[model samples]
Target: MKTVILVALLLLLFPIPVLGGESGLVISSYSVNPSTLFPGDTGKLVVTVTNTGTRSAEIREAVLYGNGLKVLSPGYSKLGTLTSGGSVDLTFVISGMKEGVYYPTLVVRGNDSTLQYPILVTVDSTEPEVLLDTGILYVNEVNRINFTIINPRSGDLTSIKVRPIVDGNVYPEYLYFDRISGGSSAKGVFYLYTTKPVETVQFSLQFNNGENVRYTNTTAPINSLPSREIQISLEKYPNEVLRYDTVVFSGNITNLRQDTIYSLIMSIEGDGIVSSRDVVLPALSSMDSVPFTIRVTPISSGTKHLTLTYMYSDVLGKIYTGSTDLYIQVPDKDVLSLNGVEIKKDGIELNIIGDVSNLGNYEVKGVTVSVLASDSEESYFIGALAPSDFNSFDINIPVKENTSTITISIQFVTGVGQLITIQQNLPVKEKPVLKEPEIPKKYYILIGLISVLVLVVVGYSWKRAMQ
Candidate 1:
């Protein structure tokens, strides 16, 4: 009777093993569904435990642990008894897991044995979005754009990278992000400006989850208004004049812009002329005539072209150019003439003689004659010549011992303010005489007498000594 009871107990305790002692309790369907989950997102973990042992076993408990992760449901599963071939299923809800790889532990306890199972889970908390304030912008205008980041998972985000692609070029330096905390949301602003008419800009965003997003836009047309045009006009008074006549040319500049201009500059370009002073003109203003004088000599009797150029900067810093031309006719070469230049021992003087039939078309102002010595260190200024129908100036230059050559620079200033200068060179020659000193004939006669007296005395003394 005891043997019969023992056999029945053993049979009940050791029901048919699933593998007949081939393997112990094993996990058949042990996995977490949707292995990847973002921050603040929920995921399901399903584990299937099976008893492959040779004897019946009881499963006591199972637990799961991970950094910054929580289980929403009971992680433990109790199996009262497991037949030779029996399996149990356990499902757990996990939430609030940080962004990273996570490992959870699954423990199963039997009446005589304990088993451990490790499961891997990944939580992603990355939200990368690129936003701009305006799609179009004007040239030379400031534009601002804003960017925001979003994290879907409840896990804390660590680092973020942003890149701006402008004009087909990638610019990593233009990116801005937050570094204080690893929050799922961040905000930033971007300011941009351009000088060109049209441009295109692009930007990209990357998150810790290895996800990338790109955005692009075309800029609007940049308008540049036309600047004001400014110009200088030159006019000569009594355009035509006789030789040795003075001519006056006046300059004036007008600002055509609606805004004011500053630093007006005026210059003259031509042959046989002078330039007026530079005048500053106000906005939308006209400058009065500025006068410049030129003296014409008989030598400069011909047609000449005079050009006056003016430049100024407007209020907007735009430069403008302006210019004008004038035609001047000098008297015929015969009507205006220089008679003759003469040099003397006491001083040098230039004689200028000219006739103005009609004063021509221009008035004769004055004349200036200058005398320059070839050997002189400096040229002497003979004041202005007397202006009349017949003009003449006597330039007296003091003669010096070393005066060898003299140059007379004859300049005629006309009544109309025209200048003409002529130059002439003259040579001065002088020879020096030296006299030879005379020697007296009496000195030679005295020396010969003294020699004869010495010879007679010597002969007489020799004869006396011999006797």
Candidate 2:
């Protein structure tokens, strides 16, 4: 009984040795040397890893990886063995060149399980500014834009670029610089093309501080010229002329203000007129008159109302419009008229004659003359007639014994799809019939006496033969 008690006590004193599951490792604490940092700044990151299981853990090394942060110091460190509940500290020196929140991952291998630790770091901000030397923008010319990049943080800024966002187009979209030290500034130039007028323009600034990529956007007001500073005058050729005449128009654009103008264009528009050209001027100086001409031919005769429009830009590239009106008079024109008609008889056919005259400003086409009798019609084509000209035509038709009247038709077509017909009635007078000459009376009485004598001789010869 004493031996049993002694064994029990000994067994209780010394525990039995048994193999169990693998060891586990975890991150105990983590810290960044400088908790707060700005772009283009350098700082240290420290991480403490501990073995939390009952057994010892053999770790190969600790590795770190993250975006927006460049590792300046060694990223890997050898951690051979970690006893139960023991802790090890690992460090990395990293630099940030862009502004944002960054999460770094730490990996440790060679133990029963792979251990990963995630760390968060925040980077401060910096920005730049842009200004236009001129108050407003103008069309058809290049405008200079100025940019100034300032470093507000304690670190250096690099890869600084300022870009202008315009509604139309801009030359050299961006201005770039290599570096700008902290608390200092750098200058750049950007050429912009403001094809149209706008109220404001946006400028975007992109740059990299040692620790982060930074961005900023700003807007500025654009001053544009108004139409009140422009003067326009219109002059026309041959103030009083006939229809279809070529009207030459001259327009003068004068800049009343001291500011210079660009892209001066004049356009003329009206009804019943055709123009072959538009006037454009490259540049107009201050207080100067730019003259431009346009030729237009009027189609119809009447009062023609013409509108002249002028568009131009100021020194800053904004567009403005102005207009002027002019009135013209075109005289009326008479196109065609029927002169006269005549009819005569020739053998068994009747001849119808008529004359047509063209009195209009334009040529008349497809003119034809036809004689319409009671039964049928006979036509003679006259083809085309020039202005202020006349032509005579005759059509012959066979008529029955007593036809006394006939009608005439003159049909013509204008080039613009207008058909005109003229009609006239002519009286026909028949020629007098001729009478045969009467035979003489004495010749008829002599023939009667000869016939009686021949009859008396025949009777006497018959009576003598019978006796």
Candidate 3:
């Protein structure tokens, strides 16, 4: 009986080991309400530690560790003494964690060993929304896209970046958000100017929590602008004249846009000549033509090219240029004239003389003299004459008794069919003899005979009278 009592007492003193909660500390229930939370969102974790052991266990403190995550509850409760089954409930609130899945470790310290529990916290962020004023902007025009960032959480947002994607390339300029007082929203403006028209533009908004949101829009088609149309025409004083002093250059312009053109410049350019002018043309329709004129003084003789350039504007306040070309001809000046003529006779030689003058600005070539007889069928040709000089030629004529009157015609002929004519008359007469013709012999003899007969008869009569 003593051995049985001793064995029973010893077996009662040493208890058998149990699988759970030998130290009188147990986690009855634990849960985290909303395991996933965003930045600036409030969340809660509930933990129940129970004492199920036979002896009492002193609870020291509980701690949680993670960046920007903290425990709301402070100090560990001391359940100084507990019977077989006893429990304590603990609650914790955490705030201010970025977007990510995080493992938060909760440590419970006791007199024996430290216990750690990993709590999973998931942070989800909302993407921002962006709005654009115009999806398509014309060249050299302003592009303004508005942005709105909505934050549903309770914390203040720090920095935000907006990037524009053009043709699959990121634009280097970043847009920033403006602070909103007493609100969880941010508004920003993105202004851009482009010289080239874009087909599509995409924008991305990045928050401080490393979350990105993208938006895209298509631009509208750009309208055609107003441009200058220049038409050139050439006018002259006499159309058939090979040479002229001045030529008139006429141009027409049509402004196809609704806006008036200011300081519209027109220029004419050609070989060795240039002219320009500026004028203002009111807004005119495509059918309306505005006329403009410029005087062109010819410098030399040849074909001259005339180019016209004009400027105009479009509806979008853009400028355009147009040009046209034309041609003109200038003739040369004249420089030759004809002078008088003279006639002289030496024995049987007939000499003709004339004068020539240089009436032109330039020298003359291939000058000659031609003579035609009025009484006979004979013609004569003279040699070339120098400029501003006179030439004479002696022509021998075969004289016949039947040739009573001689008509002399003189002409100064240039090789190019320019001729001058002069005519004169010459009379023919007989030559005088040196000695007197012999007197008639019959008359002289008769006179002598008569005188002798008279003398004889007078002598015979006197003798007879005397006897």
Among all candidates shown, the one with the greatest TM-score: 2
lDDT of each: 0.52, 0.69, 0.51
Candidate 2 ranges with C-alpha deviation above 4 Å:
1-199, 205-211, 218-334, 345-349, 399-407, 417-467
Model 3 lowest lDDT segment of ten: 237-246
> lDDT tens digits, residues 1-467, model 3?
45644553443344222223357565556655544455666667676766667777666776676544655555454535434577677677766457765556566666674555555555666444444544444344334445455555433444555676553222246776643222367665555445555665566655443221223232322232222233444343333112213344655665433333444666666774333244456555544567877644444456766676667554334566777666766555322233444444445444445444444222224444344443333445544544444444444454444544565554544322334354555554434456888889998999999999999999999999999
Query: How well is each residue in 128-185 modelled by candidate 2, as lDDT tens digits?
Result: 5555556755444455556555666545667877777888667677778788776677
**Which residue ranges in model 3 land beyond 4 Å of their true spot?**
1-124, 139-156, 168-172, 178-197, 209-268, 277-467
| Native-referenced Cα lDDT, model 3 | 0.51
Give lDDT tens digits, candidate 1, residues 1-467. 45644653453344432233344676666555444566655777887777766667776676666445777777576757776568888788876546766656566666656665556567764444444545554333333445555544444434455665543212135555543133356666555444454444555554433221223232222233333355444454776755545455554455544335566666555675443343444434433333333333333567878666667654345565766766778756423344543444543432222222223434433344455654442333334443334444455555566777766565544443445565556666443346676567896788789888899889989989999
For candidate 2, which ten residues in a row score worst on lDDT?
A: 12-21
lDDT of 3 at 193: 46
Is 1 or 2 the stronger prediction by lDDT?
A: 2
Model 1 regions more than 4 Å off: 1-228, 231-236, 242-244, 272-299, 315-318, 334-467
